[model samples]
Target chain A: MSGDERWIHTPPRESATFDKHAIAEIHRAAATGIYDIRGFGAKRKVPHFDDLLFLGASISRYPLEGYRESCGTEVTLGARHAKKPITLRIPITIAGMSFGSLSAPAKEALGRGASIMGTSTTTGDGGMTEEERAASSLLVYQVLPSRYGMDPDQLRRADAIEIVVGQGAKPGGGGMLLGQKISERVARMRTLPPGIDQRSACRHPDWTGPDDLEIKIIELREITDWQKPIYVKVGAARPYYDTALAVKSGADVVVLDGMQGGTAATQDVFIEHVGLPILAAIRPAVQALQDLGMHRKVQLIVSGGVRNGADVAKCLALGADAVSIGTAALIAIGDNAPHLEDEYRKLGTTAGCYDDWHEGRDPAGITTQDPELTRRLDPVAAGRRLANYLSVLTLECQTIARACGKSHVHNLEPEDLVALTIESAAMAQVPLAGTNWIPGKGGPF
Target chain B: MPTVDLATAPVRELNAALHSLQPSTNETVWRVQNPRGQHAIAVGLDAPVTVEIDGSVGYYCAGMNKQATVVVNGSAGQGLAENMMSGRVHVKGDASSAAGATACGGLLVIDGNASARCGISLRGLDIVVKGSVGHMTGFMAQAGNIVVLGDAGDALGDSIYEARLFVRGTVKSLGTDCIEKELREEHRMLLRSLLDAAGLPDVDAAGFRRYGSGRKLYNFHIDNIGAY
Candidate 1:
């Protein structure tokens, strides 16, 4: 064999510390004065739901016949002080993504799919769009730090209101929508100059801390006349204290977004290095809720890296009233279809590996603002695909629940799960596979 | 005229009655007695009605008000007329902090002195303070105008945006990117219109100094990232 060909069969040697990605990042950082800004969640792997395994029923326990047994998946959120609370047929809801980051058609598709599946969809930093509002039967209007398009009339129009303090991908920092995505419509909605990069303030202009937030919640209640539910969303930095504070702020529901959550645009350093993972955050947040005697009274909706039915089932088993999806939802709408492989290659990335959503050149048309690129997506068809995906997830979660002999998905508890790895066992707060031993908790009990 | 006493009616019932009133209904004018520093009075109204508070008001009084007119006879507490959309809110007595904060539209006329952050984030609202305004008046103001007839306290118009600040008296200091601009013909006309709207047509527009943003911090720059 030739010299180059011989090296293929020879054992390859590479340094894990100075890997290609690390080297490339160093080069890129050296070239550009600013930090790397990109879209999507952390690329590095961490303790996730995959590390945990469910021990299905056997002789000692009981299993239900798959088709014969009924497993309920219904969930009700926002029942605290709201005159009208929302109930969904399923426990999976769509996460908040701004109209500026996503195309109008994409937002509409998310709304359509969520509505068809009998769930709710949320608005983002840029405020509620007509297409999204019209498509979604249950729409949650987010009151972000920017307050970009906040209006009293729109406050009355929303089904529910979520006051956003922070997002997961970059907990302490704010959001960034690059100039390429800032179209005239976005500029008009946000009252900023078109084609100019926008940065949202990290804190609310009106209110500062929890004390002000308490008063702010009262003001919101008064403005809406207590007709709609109010939610307080926080990034999972200190889930215990944040959850407790949110409860004290009179939140009807609490939305906890973890580190694995995707951002439209943020510094690359912030993504991989900030906040706790969803798996590690849930127990603390649930403990906070239980401590306050508001465990099930104030529902908790979790988000971050929820991929399929297994993730939903796991999260529900861990005590989440409902789960929300963002990246998975975008994928369901054909964000990086295999058919767009050729186009993705032109952008120096392959399909399913493309994460530069802030560039606004998405081949599948889900994340782009270009007219030609956006036209590639057919909202009706994509929306149908999303609905089909949601249906499959529900079916799979139901299958798992039935196998565990659970009549309802919410009935499946942490006892039904075991960790395959020691790290997973510690993070998930569950017993190790063959042994009923929890690493952090004292003995078997 | 319809009168409502706070001592007898619960806040819920009083607010519910106020919230349910129609603009064309018989109660175009309301007299609220013995407010006694209660929070959230005359809030969330979207009618062309008039609410006259006979005594001192508390926090968030007339918050998110739309189209209706609210007149406070005594000293107003914090966050008076916060996030008001339209119409008028006239504070006859000295006002507390954050007066007309985040108010997008309408005319807020504080006849007495206004405390700190008098017109913070004033978006599309026209504020006319007859007496002096305390420190940090018009902080991060996006749009509209802040017309201070008397002396403006320290760091007036801090981190200002497109909003115009017209002050008639002494200023202690200026905040970052906030500087005085020449009062051209357009500014004179704009100042005159605000004074007229606030029923201060007698106050001369020429005596006021117009302040606005220096056009920095509008966009992100690499060299100045630290400051931004």
Candidate 2:
């Protein structure tokens, strides 16, 4: 005390455990008598792709010439049981976003962009939209618990089928399409009132566990004459166990969505507190495939917080066959654009911070059901922008692959990567920078 | 009358034969003997043909049928006449579950009982069950008419939409937003037509009680928690 008595002035410091954010949340909950519900992924900082650094070719490996030696980005998904497996020209695909949460035009734009790039787009909970079906050459139909707008004819026409076990943003939680966004078309398809808040069941009504899922897959196969591939999509909480079960259940492809993936609406507490980050989720999912001797045979698609091509290449290096984008795609189609900064400010949030999709008053017209708001987004123009973004991502991924001396994007391995942080080294199972030692997984035996 | 023994023939051959026939083909009446509880019998038939399954069929019988008339002599496993666009599927025996699920347009006649989730997510399909339906029948149904001649199990028509449900017998419990609505002259007429289409015109439409969405839980309200 005598040493500190010289001149020490410390301002009021908030509690580290109960900071301002936590206090504000407590106040909000106390006032509302309910939990905070919001859209988007986890906002809290966690170990991510930036923590891992790629070790470019220097001595032991030879880099491919960038000018002519083309790196193949093509991938074939669901070739195991389906007669007509989806063959993508690129290793990037669009993640499932429901028609209820997104406007019809936004769904169309996504389909157009995917078709232009020779990739696949997915239909989420509410059902398949006519616009999406008309625009997309390859469409993956989702079999969700609610079975809203689910038709066997649509299943037969789909290029692939995705059985969504759980989503990454809220692993065990159900989906919520607020009353404001439930338009006439959305209400008709889901069999609900036009202005009602519709909640989807977390568990499938007919089937319970993985064993039942196996029988369901067989039923779907018979329904479509084994033409379309079956994909089992799971959140990344128990990637090891879930991936193993999905493979055993006769899934041709496994889509692992990490906690960083977006949602239309969920409890804000569940979003930040539940599930694992994509960076930590990939290695374990790959390990399950390797154990079953189905690695690369049963394709794996990782999703959550994928922004640029570097992230995609990193995912492939970690043994993912492809990567899916949801929030990034919305951004590509002018979501949260600076041009709408004034409108966003009027909504009480800035342009880059506008994630209140559940409000149904989106200025960019991507996430609203209002006809006037939706009119702001021209599908043709938005689709071109999305295509440009996808092209840029592909080019960046190719650049990274070429630097790693890989002829194909799938050939990029974990050996060409190092971790910048100890946490990433442990989570991603990669060696630390400037060292050949991995903390938990010992080196060379 | 051509006969295809399903027990000996591969499913692909049988489906291929059904798929190749034109809508106007006169050789439309085909008989499938020894179905032996096989799945997806006469699926994806766009032709205006008639397929007669002589034995019990497994899951997804007559799935995605368009303009095809399918008659099953025995019970169906699950998802009978699922997503039938425009056709008629007649089942002599009971249907396991999800009978006439998500069909946009069709007439599904279940001579015997239908188990749980019967007519689940049904969209514009007209289904008439001769016997009782298990719990959660007509759940989340969009735009269709379901007629049950016998008692309904628990939570009938839970979260139902525009679909109209008519139960001749007592319902154990009504689901959220599902209430007993008055059967007016127009409703009786509509039910009479549906019953006639399902080949059950002898049944009295006045004996049935109409049930539909109460529209109370449509918008979110704190007081509506008990409804859910």
Candidate 3:
């Protein structure tokens, strides 16, 4: 009953209307001033490989000297029926890339690099070149669906054979040759009209399914007189079933590629949409091999975004016998060299943004046919760089093993990891850090 | 002439026996009786020995041969004399696909017929098939000679580079970038030498027509790119 002007309803919450605030001003300052640079590894800032650390022992564990202790990296591929097994010096091998996708000099450089590090380099859909085979101490040849330049003599000459079913970047896709990369020699090997875009067949003309593949494998073995080991490579889709099938199909080794893998030429949709991540794929493949009681008997080589020693350690801990690198190896050999920043800008991209491998107009000379640009990359120097990178990786892996009280790199286990994200927890199959909940195990969140 | 009986021999032992031969200026001939799909017989022979298989072979008989003469009386399985270098291979019956594939240097003669991709990627070798060839024959051929006495399948020399295709019979179709060309005298001369090397009785080299690339697809010119 006080004054009639005041006494309006007194509410628990306040409502006010005012002019809009400047949203872009707050975001612009934060983005440009502090948080602009992109971080390495997976795109998401989840608990990745970095979260897992080794536990060193004080009294219970013994320490091995960095120089005195022996950490062996020898891997034997195709031990099941190969007349001559391939013995490697390191656990990592270079993947199959074509002479057409990369210049002859680039191919030669990869071979020289891999050979120097006591590893192996592979040939792609295109046939093996003399320069590559001559430079490489151990070479693996790929027999693809197109049968491009497939020669029995060359097959016999190779140290090993990999029958390519699908690649991780494009599971159902085939090999692609842009018009620019098609040279006289490349055309001669692929049986295509020269200077035209070429697409390889998805399936081998002679053989159809896995049953026929078994026969084909036998035929290939017979052709080489069982001299070389045979490997079956598959994209990481239903890897459990594929691994089992590969073993049944008489493959001495199984190579599985994940979603993050790169391709010489493929559609952006295929690259981004198809295939599973390597982290999710590895456990299933290992489980399949274990179920067959063939684990570690037939080597499993996993590949995707294997960037450093931590990734290598994680893969091995997850049960991969070895790992193969393609994109990462290319990066190490100056694929996206920062020195070509100006050239990259001209291509409407930055150094890291350049992924026009299909165009064959690579500025860094890592993938191109332009004679002048290719000459910029010195094969000897690039080889030495790759070797140096490999050594650093090996050293870093050794350092981690020492910290964890593991005498060998294979001693890493899933128990050592704690996931910071639900995806990491599910993929790594470990408990979340500072929490008891596992999203997939208890139920999806 | 020596007779090697496959009924009582292993292919490995037979190859070992053949490897122990000495160089002779005179031609040494071996008649292989009852081949019955024997594999890898007389493999990697450097000497000039003539092996006459009386019947069919399993796979890769006389493979990687250098300066030898191999004649199969019947049909062959996959990869017959595959990757043969500097030799002569004559087939009395039909050949399977991929015959003379990746052959570095030699002369391959198919008297009856050839299946798909005959003389695929032939490198410096010469192939003379009396009958029809299958699809994609001479695919990606770098440098070689392929002479067809009969009709050719579709997409013959589809992505052929430098190898030459000579056909006397009708062509079902041509592959990408492969076009029919005028059979010049040089081509005729080359075909004659290949036929002569394969030891076929004189056939009319002039009757054959040549197929080659028009050189349009040799360089990528953005305007002419086709859907792959």
Candidate 4:
């Protein structure tokens, strides 16, 4: 064997080229007690959404024509009470992304993309801006604990309202906008000092708990004169309890976000280890709605790691009325690209390794305030790309629906799926690989 | 003037009645004789009209108002004059919490007292209250002036910036990084203008003290680190 070939089976001490800098950094972090915690999706490598596939239609199931068949993707959110309910042309809507975490251009791009696809975009902690509201044809305004820029005129103008109690990325943790991301405009809008790390409160100042939330809901309805639909959004920790609470609190819609969700910025440990996965959380949320006899009456929107058409279908089958996108949406519009490899290397990362969305030093210009970098993104072209990607997902969903012998996409059911793991089975609430064993089901008192 | 009694009319009908009326130069005064704490009494009126509400009002009275002058003769509820782009809204009696919350422009004058969270998340509006304010007043206030003629509560001006706070009475406590500063001449002039415009008797802008955000919390410092 040649010298290079002989090294393949050689001992680690002689063959391995250790990264001294990386090892030193790890040692320092360990000594400082900062190395124990794992960041988002880093603890264990579970089967990501990409591993799953849908069984296509065959001779056993009748297929529909690609053009002629109707695989409807429309979703009606906040149908229970909102005067101006959101009627999505597609099942996917943009998730709540804040102004303080993102730049005006980023927000505008999202709005433009969603609007082009005839879907809705939501505002986050720092509140809505005139530019965002103007750009988005259908926008959902968030009423966070901070009540950052909440106002009646804006509420009236909004198609819907989402009361954000918690997020999937870091459930129970309040919002944090690092100082570097805080611009003059964002600071002015949120009424905070420029270049300051702003922490949003965990509890609503006016209302303390779910009991008070009901009254708060009534007050909001009164203020809006029963025009806008109110939504209650929560992280996927206690899906059943939270879902019931949401319904009880008179929410027209319930939004449940899973652990795989993205954040502008959060502690690495909190993002990964704190919350339940999207798959596990969906079943309980649906059960809550079902138990309350409010299923389909009060819409359920699920989010977190929903990347492709299959993930969308799985969520729908598991009982979500619609799916919302955050990380995937950014990806569709080019968040981390190969072209930004050099910049990523400068930050000691690659395109895929880039997770410093909150640092405002995004190499791809997808999440930055730097004028030179931001100018790299052409809003119009990016919007069109997103719209196209959305169309492809819709087509894929339709293909699966046709194969499953369902005329419409909403006809997908949980029985159509089988779990690959115990965690997946628990979350999807589906039967295990071979046996019909569901862990929590049929357990004696 | 057309009189629509909210006691019998639904919120929509009452608002519709108000919206139908054309406020002309000849008709400057509008008297709501039987205003029984109706919510959103005068919402989104861009006309330069004067509405004198005779009774107490529920949440968001005269919300998103522009050019018009709304005078509530009795106590007001939460978020009174919320998001008023322009014009003036006057609450003659004690107002509930969150008075003038998130208002971007215009002047909201509360001649009596205000409860907690008064002017919370205030944008550019000017608010002048004659009595005490409860906890967390002017929390996250971005800009504009909040002049409380009486005592202020704890956590006042928490996470505040540029937004000036002028109080004449005792301060219960201050919020994180919020400190009491000396009232400068410019601040005094601004306070005087606000008082005069609101038609309130001058209560010594000198007696009133200034409160603002300490620049230390503006950036995250390695030394001053603890609970985020």
Best by DockQ: 1
Ranking by TM-score: 1, 2, 4, 3
User: Candidate 3's residue-wise lDDT over B181-206, tens digit each?
Assistant: 99888988888887777675578789
Candidate 1 vs 4: which has more lDDT: 1
Relative to the true structure, candidate 1 reaches a TM of 0.94
Task: Please compute and give the TM-score of the first chain of candidate 3 against the native first chain.
Answer: 0.85
Off by over 4 Å in 4: A1-68, A125-137, A145-158, A184-194, A198-229, A442-445, B19-46, B63-65, B226-228
Please write out the lDDT profile of model 2 over residues B1-228, one tens digit for every residue: 878998799766788788778757897899999999987788878888899999999877887788889999999988788777889999999999888877778799999999999987777889999999999998877788999999999999998878999999989998878899999999999999988888887989899999998877666776776766
Model 2: per-residue lDDT, tens digit, A11-86? 7899999999999999987988777777889899989998988887889889999978989999999999999999
**Candidate 4 docking quality: incorrect, acceptable, medium or high:** acceptable
Over the stretch A1-445, how does candidate 4's per-residue lDDT look in tens digits? 7878986785745323446645665796676654322222323344445433444566766666777778888988877887767789988889998887666667777888889989999998778887788779899999987777666667778898899999898889876677777778777667666787776767665555787678567666655667788999999899999999999999999999988888877767687678887877887899889999999999999998887888888888888898898887787777878887988899877877677777888866767766777777777777777888888777777777777767878888776677776666665667676768776675421
TM-score (second chain) of model 2: 0.97
Give each model's whole-structure lDDT.
Answer: 0.87, 0.89, 0.76, 0.78
Per model, the share of native interface contacts recovered reads: 0.31, 0.31, 0.09, 0.22
User: Residue A256, candidate 3: how far off, in angstroms?
Assistant: 2.2
Tell me the tens digit of each residue's lDDT in model 4 across B93-192.
9888888776778899998899999987677899999889999998877778899989999999987766889999989988877788888898888988
Q: Which should have the higher DockQ, number 2 or number 4?
A: 2
lDDT of 4: 0.78
TM-score of each: 0.94, 0.92, 0.77, 0.86
